[model samples]
Target chain A: MFLGVLFSGGKDSVFACRRAMETDSVVCLITVISENPDSYMFHTPNVRWAHLIAEAIGVPQLLWSTRGEEEAELSDLRDAVAAAKKSYGIEGVVTGAIESVYQAARVQRICRELDLWCYNPLWQIDQVEYLRLLVEEGFEVIVTGVFAYPLDESWVGAKIDDRLIRELESLQKRYGINPSGEGGELETFVLDGPILKKRIEILRASKTYENYRGRLTIEEARLVDK
Target chain B: MILIVDLCHKAESLSKYEFVDPIASIVRRTGSEFKVRHFSELTAKEIERSDGIVLCGTPLKDDLRARRIELFIWIRDFDRPLLAICAGMQVVAAVFGGEIVPQPKIGLERIEILKETDLLGPPGEIEGYHLHNFGVTLPSGFDLVAGRAGQIEAFKHSGRPIYGIIFHPEVRNKWIVERFLDLG
Candidate 1:
């Protein structure tokens, strides 16, 4: 079956796209860019650069914009998905939702309305184990945002590796933070992965941190050879 | 050993990770051994060797109508504790002479447990994750365990330990799955 993934250029969505590719053809990558940085429905950090990730992965991308109002953005999502169905003839939609019922349920409702099958490959997954899987599976993911305490400026631009995974595991036990950032404690962006045809090279980026909230804005990036 | 039967559209389909693996993970976390097999690939020998059976859900778009519902004829005679979820519930109900009605639901909703069983303890209201295009009617010879008669949220066989629930227990109600394992 041909499917379209709700891509955020994040580790979860990237990994989900790869998993979807294993069983079926991922015909397109659908990215919903929200103006609200704290949008509950979609990931926000450096999502506009999703086209680059799409180009790197060699999948056609469908970009949609939303004003990011809480309930109103869902209609924008519906429009985007409807457009994907019309353009790509996608039979279903794939999501990276792991534990957020709020996000997963809304997407499920939209898919049902659109008569498209929805798949959340990372639903109810073990967070720490999944972070480990991301590194072990050759996914070069970096933290792009941090929202919770005890995670300071250092995490904003760090690559996810064994050392970071160990630290996240310890933080999970000590501070009750979700290692995979399912709880909105952190956000990630995938630069390279097993499924990507090319890797992302960050040319220049700026980091901003204050009082346990931080974001790494990728000002410039280009696709490079893996 | 618990047998987790995958009811997705096909064996090893993309839906397996969403529907099957989570339940398998929950069962594994209980320290009980489990084996996962698609409904079409399940053998009588596999069923006979299992202590309990958990028929997992599927993507809402991949209901049992696309597959051979007759393959589930084994459910009628199997006396072990069997818990069917979502599409699996539709199969269990269809096998037992029940109607599969169009009751499309998605997202987290309130579930009222009308009849308490070993699987779901006591009658109360609890929120459960529901993602299905259809729901099963109360199959004959099955007691209404939850929800109203027509819109059965949960049901159990009158004489056996067989059960069917529309909600995906692997979501917020994983205790139900762990409790089903305990029923083994």
Candidate 2:
């Protein structure tokens, strides 16, 4: 059966897509862009990188833009997924929802309404183990946003490695971080992956720290053929 | 190090929800360690082996069954410091002599600390997220620590180390988590 993978260019979504491809042919990658500055639904302000990841994965990418506001954004997502499913004749959809029942439940509801099977392969996996596997699998990931108190601008562009994993373990021992960034403590963007035929070259970037939050903006980036 | 008891299978993922990073930041700031494991992973002996215990929030709406009863018994006998948020708070109330009944759907709201307690720090109002339908009616000997709009927002067992807050401190302001880490 053909499936659509929800691509966020994040470790979780990439891993989920990888696993889904192991069992099913994923036809399209879907991403939702939010215009709202304080949107809770969208992962980041810009998702242009997601387009490159979709290209690397050898799948058609669909960008669905929304206001990023709560209920309205959710509606837009539901519509987007439904449209993708219909247009691509997809039988199912895959998500990388590690936690957050609100997110999972909403997606499930949309899938149910669209009459498409919803697959969340990484739903209940241990967060620490999941993070470790991402590193072990040679997925080159970098921190793009730091919203938690302990994480600062220093964490931006930091690679996910053994040292970072150890730090996560230590943080878990001390602060109650999920170690997986499941609690919105941090956000990441994958620059390269196993399925990637090219690497992302960041042309220009800037880090802005305000209100104890650090956001790394990718001013310019392009996919370089490897 | 902080020991968070994973009550429900889905509750473990609550750590991945909002404010997870900030909580991690606090942990890193304090140079402490934290671990999230299922309740079944801990025995009575293990329960006694931590600096502090945080009962993570669960999606389970009600905890009035036999399994919950057994778990509550274990928590009551365990004399370690405890902090409960959202569903954790409801479980705490039910475990103690307090009662948990359906309350209004109050989303994110500023919690006014009615009294100064070490759990929340010097008395001041703080913004906290509330996503539970159950509210607690404190039993005797459990003093209320904080509240919002006349609701029993937070309460601590006077003679024991158990504490419960109706709102999610982990998802709220960083100070609440800082105070919780201080317990460790």
TM-score of each: 0.98, 0.58
Per-candidate RMSD, Å: 1.2, 8.7
* Reference A-B contact fraction recovered by candidate 1: 0.89
Worst 10 residues of 2 chain A by lDDT: A39-48
Candidate closest to the true structure, highest lDDT: 1
TM-score of chain B of each: 0.97, 0.81
lDDT for each residue of candidate 1 in B49-133, tens digit (9 for 90 to 100): 9999998898888865435878989998999999999988999999999989998888888999988799999999998988888
Off by over 4 Å in 1: B65-67
- Model 1 earns a TM-score of 0.98
Error of 1 at B139 (Å): 1.6
Error at B35, model 2, angstroms: 4.6
